[model samples]
Target: MPQIMQMGEHAVIGLDGLEALLAGLKRRDYRLIGPTLRDQAIVYDDIGGTADLPQGFGDEQDGGRYRLVRRGDARLFGYAVGPQSWKHYLHPPMLSLWRAERHGQSFDIIESEEILPRFAFLGVRACELNAIALQDRVFLGDEYVDLHYRRRRDGAFIVAVNCSHAGGTCFCVSMKTGPKVAAGFDLALTEVLVGDAHSFVVEIGSAEGAELLAELPARKASAEDLAAAAAIVAGTAANMGRDMETEGLQDLLARNLDHKLWDDVAQRCLTCANCTMVCPTCFCTSVEDASDLAAETAERKRRWDSCFTMDFSHLPGGSVRNSAKSRYRQWMTHKLSTWFDQFGTSGCVGCGRCITWCPVGIDITEEVRAIRDDAPK
Candidate 1:
């Protein structure tokens, strides 16, 4: 339910008010999860408050390279996407499914009773919002619903942050996914820093967001404040670090199944699955059942898997896609081309984790261009 008058309204809040927003969510029993500096990289973890945010920190990311740098400004949420995404929380890498105890004649099955977190994701980016939505179609679809994901997702509150600056590998603008957050958030923020004025221009997206704003000390956004926020997003869009020609991209790849570029890229690929591991929309998993020596008790667990692994395509007799070329093609085509056939949208939101985190610097955008460049006339 929306407080019709408050929904879509914009307000400005200073740093102190931003801290209060976190405290308010905490008072509502929501565990704070956001980015923080750890081990020389900005990583998402439990945040106590605004202090845990990566203030005055920015990142330099290119294919196969990432480094943290000081921004010299006390601006929180100033960095680009890190190696991890919100999927790490919503759809965990590993989860226990069930357990069984054998008692001679029959086995008793015990369902997993792990407690789910009521999360308030503090600094979600626009591209990430798209990633989360795509995942919802996978886990909460009409055909089959993952109860574990549903429970966690239902209780989560999203605080989206429009990108103040783009990353070296970013192409969310080309993907039509970002620079500015369009939808799918409880509250959206645009960090505005002009001269001595450092504040967040907040956009209320729901009744809950409106109620939360009521608790915070904020003022109505002025036309100049809103324009400044718009300018920042527009600047980010103009200087996008990368771009891909997506027109008929699905058809382009569908026509190049035998392209030599696949072989060339595969030769450089380690089949390490680093790209899939960091991809926010990737949902593949492998289930394992473990037992003790006597086999009296057993547990079933599900963990993230990747198409890059030979075992991922294994069938009854042997692996289906045995060659590295085949595996690499499967991943890229599925993400950029075949995903639309299955999910009605692209799997990639162009956050570029796959590009930046790849050990061998294989850029997905470059690969797409290579295919387009060599397509049969």
Candidate 2:
């Protein structure tokens, strides 16, 4: 179901094309969800039409954070990424697996069933793509695939974006995952505002993308178009503030487990679980069992859990990490240091969601820098 278009180099599509693309997905019964300015933040929600998108909306971010603001123009999709990543839909924070009902002699297990709606997520950021990949490694490729997650991810489609602007807390360039769109996306778009043409230079990354491209009216690209996109990304890369040297970090944290730097961070951290809640890679969860008044019927639900919780590491002997310092160390070490040994990849995508959403403004980048810089001394 694909049609190929030979793009010379300057192939660009107008804003109308974006609408057409959404309509096409709707025809195919794909639920198109995208970003909308809500609660002083950009949150993804059901988009019945283009107007639902955050038009002329942007965000101001800081050490731990985001606040939405009006933009210069009313470009619906003009905004950059948001703290609410695609994981909210793909890997739901809380979900019900099944329910059990007691009968005269036996009990019935009612499994939760969702038709696995087809989705087309627009405006996905590069770091978000990495986050999805990391989640895939856990839910799909782990010892057990989360049936709910697999259902949502397998049938969903992606439309990634190259960031034209970076927020205050953004460090994707430092993480080497952004400023430009890369792999793991069906289609990538670079919004170009050149001379008088304000359009997007789109690149098809999959067979499905080719089919979508055929439906849109686009012209051949010129060298100038490519150059403009490169310039945008290059400029963005240079503007990034935070720098994280993750080289040999996994080994360093694993070796130096008793470092005193963690205590400093612990004193500042409240263990309020904000970091894990916003983090896309933190997948640890716990389950709850609820019973009706008669206690004959019960419903079980799984919810996101945090290692910062007092009982997160509770064992038969005792709590492995009793002190806040030990809990903080366990979290940071797992995030930047020991995750490699467990998951074979960096547990962080550097989306800065953790930093921006933290109520106390505890910066993960600064913490890592302090530990990394002092490790040598």
Candidate 3:
């Protein structure tokens, strides 16, 4: 057995070593989840090995647009954030809360017996890491705790990947969240491709991460390797595809509740909830209870719901946010402005998934700028 690694250790590993790392995680009984080619796009799914990674594939992302493009070099993690995030694994879209069965006017309640999965998240980006941390605040907070989220989160291992290239819609630099991973990962990897040599500079963050690294055939990272990795991250930061002026953004949105720009955006908004669906931190959900035709079995289930839906804000009389303008306002303002007051952090991570996945190409940063520009002086 390989010795467990300690914190603050740096090492270098080749492509073959990465495969060994995967096999090692499997041996520890972790279900591997990472990005792979699916339906012409890179999506997070079950992986057998590193071969399942989307190698030599980059992505093009802009407002309401996403496409996969082939890269000249065979870099395993050469793309930016895709449509699907690690949230799909952590916070499932649909979940069963509980179930009950009836017998002659008597009811027997049964808790959900859903088996939890221990996930080893591979290829997590910096912005995505921040998003995960934000959700942790929501689910694993001091006052109230989500046992389901806590159990799954506590058991998962993280493998964060530093961005080598910026996406067309990325603004993680302006958000101060990406290009270079800060923390919250078991192991962080920076892919280095120089001349004919290709390897990963690994930074061990936790004891488990260190133990996993010890399983691989890794060498101590040289000064040149560290410099190369830093250069790649710096280059990505310098070439960010988008920018958001976050200074006083919370107050800005608070003052512009009735901004005309909201009305303008509503014209193009579909209220399809794609932004909320793709957003890694949008945690809104609705619950329902239903019984079988024979009224013998009943279940309580929870499904993801967005504020944009007409029924989401329905009251005793009618829907409070009846207009598209109000729904868009609620989402954008809550995400960029009021979320700080509620969560002690900004809701948006600047991943640009909400922008790329929005059918009408509604850019959150652009809307913020417009609101600020049009605000009373």
In order, candidate lDDTs are: 0.92, 0.79, 0.91
CA deviation > 4 Å runs, candidate 2: 1-3, 6-10, 74-80
Judging by lDDT, tell me the better candidate of 2 and 3: 3
Which residue pairs in candidate 1 have backbone atoms (N, alpha carbon, C) closer than 3 angstroms, thus clashing?
A: none
Q: Model 3 residue 287 lDDT?
A: 95
**Model 2 CA lDDT for position 28:** 79
Cand. 2 TM to true fold: 0.94
Lowest-sum lDDT 10-residue window in model 2: 1-10
Across residues 109-131, which tens digit of lDDT does each residue of candidate 3 receive? Answer: 99987687689999999999999
Q: Candidate 2, residues 1-377: lDDT per residue as tens digits?
A: 13366432235677787777778888879999888767777888878766777877887777765778887865555555666778788878888889999997799999998777798998888888888988899888867877888889987878887887777777887777786777887778887775556788887777787677788777655778788878877887777646677777788787677788877877888889988887877888899999999979999898888999988898999888888899888888888877788788788877777788888898888887777778864
| Per-residue C-alpha lDDT of model 1 across residues 1-377, encoded as one tens digit per residue | 12233888899899988999999999999989999999999999999988889989999999999999999787898899998999898999999999999999899999999787699998899999999999999999867899989988997998999999899999999899998998889999999887788899999998899899888888888898899999999998998888999999999999999999999997999999999999999999999999999989999999999999989999999999999899999999999999999999999999999999999999999999988988986
Measured with C-alpha atoms, the lDDT of residue 115 in candidate 1 is: 81
Q: List runs of model 3 lying over 4 Å from the truth.
A: 1-5
Candidate 2: pairs in clash = 9-221, 10-221, 10-222, 11-221, 64-355, 64-356, 65-356
List TM-score per model, in order.
0.97, 0.94, 0.98
What are the runs in model 1 whose C-alpha is more than 4 Å off? 1-5
